[model samples]
Target: MKKSPLYLSILSVFLIAAPFILTARYTQHVLIVVLLYVALGSAWNILGGFAGQLSLGHAAFFGIGAYTAAIIASKTAFSPWWALIAGPAAVLPVALLVGWICFRLRGPYFTLATIAVGEVVRLIALNWTTLTGGAVGVVIRPSLLSGTSKLPYYYVVLVIAVVTVTLCHLMSRRKLGYYLMAIREDEETAESIGIDTTSYKLRALALSAALTAMAGAFYANYFLFVDTTTVLPLALSVEIVLIAIIGGLGTVAGPVLGAVLLKLSSEIFRNEFAQANLLIYGALLVLVILFMPDGLMGGFRRLFGVGARKSQRVSA
Candidate 1:
């Protein structure tokens, strides 16, 4: 059974009112984080979940986007808003190149290739001082959030999050998404059916890179800085995949659900006990993976049997 339209409506209404209700900067910041992860997780879901291309190199795209914007902002007079578009544009070719190189392998090889590529990119960014500022990082001259409450930035991210979800929803109903699913389910079979698996996977990677770049642009502008370690870290890439896994792979609402629950919990734990956040996160992840391997959404739907499921041959 699909989620009730009324339930979804209520949830949307609540989310819309949350920023207004919670006036504190920190609380609002946490909410913003939830939205941020919602986008990040969803973006990763496109390639990793829907297409079954477990990329551990997404941070490469993310770092490219952030560095693109940061470099532009530091060297020129372009607005940060331009970074939104430029970020994705810059990463698209890079993503296509990476896909061309990495799509040759299958299964664990692909995953390992992604990890290696991500490390290579990070190392390059760390050493490329003239362009990326090396370990020193690039700082924006004027902050996007300067003289503004977190509210404006909150809405900006919310709009982007909405766009990301809407695009996923639309894509799920279309031919490209179906091709991706076919490839995911069985690549050889998909190839036998005349689907160009390599091309489709490349397309998915390109789109995923674009979306990730958008998020990276926002993150860099919001934070007013970008560094190789911070933007291109292996942990960030792993976090993207984990968020999707924790929710529900191949399900549209899975990433959102995972991001909300996981990011919120982490933030709360960090606030309460900063030093133990990783320990808590690791323990929670292990418990969840052990008990609910299908992720929070899959577990919930399995129990309740009343939500939109990707297995029903429906939207992602």
Candidate 2:
């Protein structure tokens, strides 16, 4: 299929001038958060969207990355840059082990196992006082670039977001994506068709965990703080899942669009409605699930009839 010229042009323009376009410090800060969620959402989609593996333990991996980076850097004088690589590397083995154990289960049983794994990780972070700094949380001095400046952080996160999206795009166009989709549709059928369902599923989980963990490492360094409540919380995992679902689970751009819209809407609600923001957010989520299950991007595609004909062709 030919790529969309308009989409490519817009992307190029945005990448070239995002810094100039976002002049306000507050705007830049919000953009950073949006980009972070966008990356995280895309990462989650690898497993949930591509492989049909529902993981409720992503925040556990996220926290593992953050804490690993923080502790290694703080204790050994290693660059946080190095920690970013190390943190995700540390998470890969754990994700593989978990995948190996839980891939035998299907549906909700697997999902429940993931949730339990997350809780176990969170409990460890909360109780391991000497290693994780316990409930007090580890605080690092601000970066030499200073964490307060939004511009530098914005560019840094923007680069990461670009890389993340590119990786997702590449993966989605490859054989791995086809295998994942086959598994998502029917694991048994996929296996019958000569796909190594177990190994592919494990690969999906590992890649998802590694990417999410890298985001966590960046969050720790950018925010200069790591706490179990913020990093390892179950709520964080839920948010990741929500973004991916609400954006259009299986599509490449769905999670990115979902993150931007949700984050922006939530921010607006927080600023204007304050105490009532949660109510509004909850209501919005319910509405989206009920009426727009395929999400904003999905709706857009449907409205334009770009993919509808293809879908119809397949169905026919």
Candidate 3:
């Protein structure tokens, strides 16, 4: 029999309470950053993992979202809730346009195109001093309740993290998910099987962009500031991809695992030994990629035969 939802609920309860129970502010902050990357990694997987579209420019959507939310909150008296929608809303058209152009290309070309797009967005954010406050960035006023409290920010990011992961799970099981997977495996074969590969890729890109934008919104609010480097940096995009890759691409839990492991390790390294942390981080990533290209989750599943056994049991 399939595992009961009750078991899953209990697990979730334990996870939610564990951090508070530990009562370590530093640990909580690390967890918050993990949640942020988890959302971003999952969102990136919608295209990179599902559709096999390697978009290195995902930070563009992220930056757009951050800027949109910042602008709305700064200029008007709009509620922070609305800022969430505003960020994703602003990036939709750009995503669609980029999808139209780059989706036509395959493999490395598409990846390069995405990198260029991210750079363009970053440049715009840097130069648009009047609007984006230039490189200095815009500071956000604290929210009404628990101003500057880490707990409130932590919960907000956690909610967005949960929502993002949930959405990715649903998408992976839906028709669109199948279509994207088909294209990922073989575009020509998918087309031969009567799938509209182009349209499906575009759809995946749109969804990925929107979801990533939402993460950006939360990041801006949580940090209470927005800058070109922080929001649209190439390193940020790479970090998201690295998390998904290290976790396990094309699996629901891969990005989550990857994000948590990578972010936690990085944080610990930075805190414990600020010097040579990046070198250590880079070395670890290289090792993971070299030994297990399919990622940590994939290796675990293979080693334990979890996926194979489950499928076999289902078939039986």
Off by over 4 Å in 3: 1-7, 146-148, 308-316
Error of 1 at 43 (Å): 0.6
- Candidate whose lDDT is highest: 1
- What TM-score against the true fold does each predicted structure earn? 0.94, 0.94, 0.93
Query: Mind sharing the TM-score for model 1?
Result: 0.94
lDDT of 3 by residue, 235-287 (tens): 99999999999998877789998998899889888888899899989999999
Clashing pairs in 1: 252-316
For candidate 2, lDDT tens digit of each residue in 90-138?
9998999889888888989999999998999999999989888999999
Residues forming the 10-long window of minimal summed lDDT in candidate 2:
307-316
Give lDDT: candidate 2, residue 261.
Answer: 84
Model 1 RMSD to the real structure? 2.4
User: Could you list the CA RMSD of all candidates, in the order they appear?
Assistant: 2.4, 2.7, 2.3
TM-score for candidate 3, residues paired by index: 0.93
The clash count of every prediction, one per candidate, is: 1, 0, 0
lDDT of candidates 1 onward, in order: 0.87, 0.85, 0.85
